[model samples]
Structure formats: structure tokens, C-alpha cells
Target: MGESGAYRRLPVAERRRQLLVAALDLFSHRPPEQVSIDDIASAAGASRPLVYRYFPGGRQQIYEAALRSAAEQLTACFTEPPAGTPTQRLRNALDRYLAFVADHDAGFSALVRGGCVTETSRTTAIIDEVRRAAAEQVFVHLGVPAPGLMLRMAVRSWIAAVETVSLIWLDEGRQPPADQLRDWLIDHFVAVLTATAAGDPQSSEVLSGFLAAVEGQPRSVR
Candidate 1:
């Protein structure tokens, strides 16, 4: 279709969606610093002015839209309870996360590694929400207090660990495959939780230290 005809035909919502999707794809391969309005326009099959018409705030707005999309996909599986034990729930969560990453690798990569988000308030809020949700889930699974200080610590550590492992996997082109990594994560969590429940002081202490270290940090998200 001609540019003017295409622009006239696309609804505002459709145009915004297209811009967000294309911007995310571009941001994944490079940081926001390297991305431009023209790149997003070409990628989205829309005119340059059309892209800006939908995203007047430019790159930052596009970055936020990308983040929202990434968050939606990643958090979808955790919205419901699994059909088994706590260990099963954790396994299921891991499976969902890996699948999301695999399917939306570009978006996930942009959000986590491409350095689009910069504002402290926005970044912290996003991280806090993700960490709180994760911690609450783990606490519920373990029959622990959800809002307790320990839960906060646990959540922070969990987020940090997940992000760290995710980056390593992404850099290595996800060596050993997502299924292998998912299984390994499940086994590790089960072992550690079992040890903690069995009153292993070393396990408790190690976990506590890890949690504390993450919680003490100011910015948990990047």
C-alpha cells in the first residue's frame, strides 16, 4: 500500500502496536542510544512521521511500550496456580519464563540487556513490582509470611539470580537449551528449599546472606 493510504487505513491503536513491536525488535539488537525514529518507522512499515505521531515522546516512549510487552508475556504464566506441589509450581514458573524468553527473545533481550530504561523511578517501580510478585509466590509456596521482611529479601535475591542467569544464557546463545536450564533450576530450588525445611543451618544462613545482599542494593532492575 502507498504510505498515505496505509497511514489513513491504520487505526491509532494498530499504529501504536506496530510501532512498539518494531521498536522492540530494533532495540533488542542495539541499545536505545543507537536506535532512532527513522529505524523504528522503517521496521514498522510506517512513515517516519507516522511513527512519531503515535510515539511523540520518541525513543523513551517506545522503550516503555517494549517493556510493557515484555512484562506481559513473562508474567502471564505466573498469574494462575499450578496443579501440584510447591516444587511443581516453581518448575512450572521456570518453564513459562524460559518459553517466554524463547518466543520473545528480542523483547526480553532489549528490556534486560539493551539499556533502554534509564529513569530511576520508572526502573525501580518495575523491579519492585516484579520482585514483590515473585517473593509473594515463593512465600506462599513455602507457607511463609508473604509481607514479612524475609519475603522481601527472598524476592530481591530471586530476581537478581534470575536476571543474572538469564543474561548468561542469552550471551551463551542459551547453551544446553531452555529445557535443560529449566530442569536445573527446578532441581536446585527443590534441593535448597528441602534443605532449609530440614533445618539445615548452613542452607538457611547462605540463603539469608544472598537475600540480604540483593535487598541492600538500591536499583534491582536495569
Candidate 2:
């Protein structure tokens, strides 16, 4: 085959990934409702029939697939190795997450806020899975194999705060800089953990560890 011809025959996985990337790009810039298969095909340098061939369920299938792909990536943002203090580790994780929000502003907003016509039960579940996965990671970072009620609630609350603040940051045109947002979020997490610690022994232990880890690092981090 000629060099040009070689470029036309991607493996099945590569072709699907290419299409999903294109679709995600579109979804990130515009609402999912505004995106079309033709637009995805054009963006991917593939034909409409080709898109259908891979995704027989059509646009809805492609949208769901793209969302699943995005969810996987988002979930990974919180699963970093537990190498640093809880605050430092969370800062690193939040950096990745906020970067994702900034990169996929429109799509992130739509996914979190819902109300998209193409949304389905499966899509909603997938999005929820990301939140659960994130909260689990936070617990893992705290070294809590089995978190108590208050500790669990505190972690989940922080996760929800991160999502809410991310959406608001996007709406506000990403103001105050991403670092500032990340720091503020870390503070919020500390506050939530501290509040929970007062009433829960498990949370008190975790909070002590977190405080010791950040001790003498910097006032801002404290």
C-alpha cells in the first residue's frame, strides 16, 4: 500500500479513539445538543457511514461513549499515588481536575448540570460513578479503609464542593487563577475534615495526620 493509503486504514481501536477524541473536542467547546455526527466525522476525517459503522446506535451511542471516556479520565484525576501530605496530594489531584474542567468547560458543565436531551440513565450513572470514585480516592488517601459516617460524609461533601466550584469557575471565565482555586479547595477540604473531626474519632485521627503532614510546609498550605 502507498504511504497515503496506509494513513487511511487505522486499526479498529485507533479509529474509534480518533472518533471519540473528535466528538469530545466538539462536546468540550459546544453543548452536546449542538454537536452532530457529520461534525464529528468531519473533525475525525472519517465519513458519516464510517461513524455509524462503528457506532450503530448513532449519535446517542457516540455521545455516551465519549462521556464514558471522559468519566474514566476524570476518575483517574483523584487516584494519584499517596506520596505526600493529604493537602499536597489533594492539590495535585485538584490541579489535574481543574485543568480538565478548563479544557472541557462546556462538556463538564453539561455533564454535571444535566438537562441535555441526549442524556440517559446510563450516562447519569457513569457521571455518578466518577463522583463515587473520587470520594473513594479521598478516603484512600486518608488511609481510611473503612470510614465512619461523619468521615465519609465529609469526604463526599468536599467532592461535591469541588464540582460546584469547578462549574462556577468555568462560568466566571476561570477567574482567580487555577492555583488559587486549588488552594481554596484544599482549605475547604481541611475545614470540612476539621469540623467532622470534632465529633468523630476516625476523622480526628485523619485530621491529625493531615495537619502533621502539612506542618511547617507553608502558612498558605496550612
Q: Which candidate is the best by lDDT?
A: 2
Q: Write one digit per residue (lDDT tens) for candidate 1, span 149-220.
A: 443444556566777787788779887688788878766654544455345543464345334433553221
Name the TM-score of candidate 1.
0.74
TM-score of 2: 0.93
lDDT of 2: 0.86
Runs off by more than 4 Å, candidate 2: 1-8, 216-222
Estimated TM-score for each candidate: 0.74, 0.93
lDDT of each: 0.63, 0.86
lDDT of 2 at 210: 82
At residue 129, candidate 1 shows an lDDT of: 70
Model 2, range 22-135, lDDT digits (tens) per residue?
A: 999999888889999999988987788888888999889999999999998888888787676677788899999999899999989988899998888999999889998998
